[model samples]
Target chain A: MKLTKFAMAAALLTSIAFTSCKPKDSEIKANVEAALKADMKMANTVVDVNDGKVTLSGECTDAECKAKCESTAAGVKGVKTPVINNLTVAAPVITTPPPASTATVLDAATQQKVKDGLKDINGVTVDFTADKAVIKGTVTPANRMKIMQILASAKVQSDVSGLMDKK
Target chain B: MALQDKYAQLLSAAQTHGVENLSVAEQNGVLHVSGTAKSTADYDALWALYGQIDPNMASGDLMMNIDVKAAAGAQLKVTTDSTNLNIRSTPSTEGEVVGKAAHDEVVTLVEKTDDSWWKVRTAQGEEGYAYAQYLSPM
Candidate 1:
């Protein structure tokens, strides 16, 4: 009778040891899900636990967000190390600019403004057409910037295609 | 939009640097950006970034009309390339030269007569209009 009791005790101890060694997969999944819930970005992330290993799969806004989700999963108490990160970075959104306005006309006053602005910079000449100033001259990079700034300040459009870089 | 993407970093920097009254528009296939930079350093940095993005700004697709912030009575430094800034009696080159502010001289802004000219006064009490291009806000 004593021998049978000893055998039963050994069997119970072995079962307890196995249960303590590995947490239930369902419990681990719930824990990881709870941890990931802290971040709104992780709301779409799906958590799966199998044999204490956690696998996170979802779409993250960016690489940084994806890595954050993986780390969060790995930090769960029952989760195994090196959590599988199958998150994908969503494609960036492209926005279109507003439509172009009709061609602008440069009045004589505006043209004279451009002329007055360019008087200081030598080797440059400007001719005002219907809508834009057609400039043709060789100008240093500094002078080129100055011309552009001056034209902008005058609110006049320019066609500098004829302008050449000063050597 | 392509032009906007090409100049994305520049626009982003403008926002990061706190450019006031910033306005960006695309018209006639040209990108026009205008704003007031907080300082001359910010304006120069933006220009340098522009040159870096577009070598010598040859594309001619972007028109950056950034102005440095300054008020009446603000201190301005003469930024001419080692030349005395001619203070004129009027806002135009046709105006008579009244006084001269040496290179690197700090002058007080009297008024922004226009985009291309400003009325300024020197330490020696000489007051006249100077080309706005050669005066940088200190």
Candidate 2:
């Protein structure tokens, strides 16, 4: 009888030991999720634990993020080795920049457009050089704005240094 | 980027005012800014900011080619300085004067002939090309 009682006690102790050694799958999942939540990059990752095996699934921004997630799940306590990394790396975003403004060439036709624009504004005269229009004469502030607007519309560069502010 | 830094306020304002198709570039010591402002008030405000940044706009370091948004059939006001805006047979001064739009007179835009000229029609049913600078979209 003593021997039988001793065997029963040993059996109960062994069962308790086994229960303490392996955490429940739900407990493993909670622990792994907590570990992943500590990292902002892992926020989007989905953590699933089944029989101590961890499966990570979701979109990672890059390969580095995916690898880090796998390592992170593997390091969690009670997690099985070789965490399943089903995380997909998202495709890189491509943004086409707006077109850059090009330099305006002062050709004869363009210079003529500048001249035609200046015809209505009095007191301003233009001389076309190799690259830019050389503007001279006294102009009221309003007319000065008009002259500049005209030159800009025609895309003609100008040396307005000779222009004087009309009092 | 020095020119860009110098004109950062103006550039930021352009963005804030919702200038469409805004393009900014620096070349040969000059900064070229091109865009279409949403309204005439916004265009004037930008010009005012430009003048404030560069006194008298005499630096010649910036060439801003901003146009106000005006579509065909939009009403335009003749903005001439107390004189009648001459409508011409063609887009240039060489064209014969076809009609006249008085200062502050409202007219309808037929087409944008070019940057410097637009085809406009007055209330009197006369239609021809007029200098775009003298016509402001209402």
Candidate 3:
């Protein structure tokens, strides 16, 4: 009886160790799959997080989506500079308006005000479509003025997006 | 009386346009202007408003109290070309050289003088005069 009890305790300890030793690869793979499944918009993508280093793989719709994925990874706790590969860019196609959770609309006068406000800053592109407002452009370190001018006056309903999209 | 009347008018106009707590008073023909602005660039417009009020403010009896105390509306980034750009006592080199600044640093262009020297901010938030030549809308 004593030998059986000792054997049972040893087996229980071994089982706990085995459970704790799940492969890091599987954990990262599960996380990536979960993210992709949760959001169908993220296609052709793979995410790898190991010891705080993130490697985002796969081609995305545009530079904005690629950047968005990288930023999302960076926001994760302990995440370092994401090694973003397998990403390419194409002209942005507006299939349907970004989800109500992802988009916001400004009234006529306020939208005009934002447009006029953006003109004062250089190296920024602001396009106002009927269904949505898209702001995407590149700002060199030398021309960061454009960043402030855009963010300063940019007022969306909420986190719909700041004034400037670092495209 | 013309300047006073117009200053009052401009102050009222600023309040109407969402510029709050703005006060304008002229003493002995010198315009003592005081208010908060949204950004450093926004104040360039205040001077324009002042110009419409009295164009003679150029090289004339007009003093402005434009304290660049943390603009509330907008965040402006001011950069300097030369590293450790010397901040002197006066606009001239002969004046006492006070401190230094770094490159790509953002600050506020709080004031402008007749000599075209713009009083900008430092990374440490110290207000210093920078030559207008090395500076522009940023």
Candidate 4:
């Protein structure tokens, strides 16, 4: 009888250890997110885990990013399936940027300001370094002038030209 | 209020911003919104509104399917001066770099996600956004 009891206790302990090895949903989610963030391509992806199933939602630049995210999630401990849903791929558009114009160099401060100002501008992109600000995308002539003036005030070189297809 | 009702303002904003084929459905306290946003700003505004209502998206009650479209198949030249272009997961530089395109390498443009980023798929099928400045139409 003692031997049988010992055997039963051992079986119970084994089951408990097996169950304990499984991670909780939240833990799995964190693990997946951490793994993804470590990857530059999956950095922006959001991970959601429920009952061992993982769902990745966010803007993925292309199919490759989405696939990698899914694979990463699936490889996580306790993840049953990795689903890629609501991840949109922003395709490229053929745009007729306005004729090339002079490239102006702007200071870092002015470059930052230009980027901030154009944040809400539709289809507008601002890129600048310590010495130059390059604004692309379609913008109104008035808005273009306003941007240039901002750069001018900061004594930074500005290139308010190129990719200036009138919006 | 129902989850969908809670997000009424966000729905209205999405509508006002011209999200195409907009649809809203709620189940078990989760609100789902599916539509096509006209631009990145339009899509962002919806999320911003959600943030105003639910900070850090704590509730996780909303599922957004808003999508943006761009040219299906276009080729762009990488003109990142001389440095290899980083292919990001999102249109923003803050996005994760999933792949890379060598300078001057011709990448198939997937979409102009916004002014700053062009979604491109490389010849090997690796896809991501290259800085718009570094890319020119072929």
lDDT of 4 by residue, B1-138 (tens): 478678889988988998998877664455656676776557556766865876434344665645443365867777543667788887665679899888789888787664445688999899887655455564
The DockQ-based CAPRI class assigned to model 4 is: incorrect
Tens digit per residue, CA lDDT, model 4, A1-167: 99999999999999889868899888988898898998897898877777788878888888988777788788887888536465677686678764211222454433554464454356777676554566667766444434443333233454554546473
Best by DockQ: 2
When summed lDDT is taken over every stretch of 10 residues in candidate 3 chain A, the lowest stretch is A151-160
Ranking by lDDT: 2, 1, 4, 3
> Could you say which candidate leads in TM-score?
2
Chain B: TM-scores of all predictions: 0.98, 0.98, 0.48, 0.58
Which candidate should be chosen as best, given lDDT against the real structure?
2
Q: Chain A TM-score for model 2, please? A: 0.49
The candidate with the higher lDDT, 1 or 2, is 2
lDDT tens readout by residue for model 1, B1-138 = 988999999999999999998889887678888889999999888988998998766676777878899999999999776678889898777789999999999999999887778999999999999888788998
Question: Model 3 residue B60 lDDT?
Answer: 33
**Model 3, stretches more than 4 Å misplaced?**
A1-167, B17-21, B59-61, B71-76, B79-138
What DockQ do you compute for every candidate structure?
Answer: 0.20, 0.45, 0.02, 0.02
Tell me the chain A TM-score of model 1. Answer: 0.51
For model 2, residues A69-165, the per-residue Cα lDDT tens digits are 9998899889999999999999999998654345667777788788887777788888988878899999888888888888888877778899999
Clashing pairs in 2: none
Worst 10 residues of 1 chain A by lDDT: A96-105
Q: Which scores higher on lDDT, 3 or 4?
A: 4
lDDT, residue B86, candidate 1: 89
Clashing pairs in 1: none
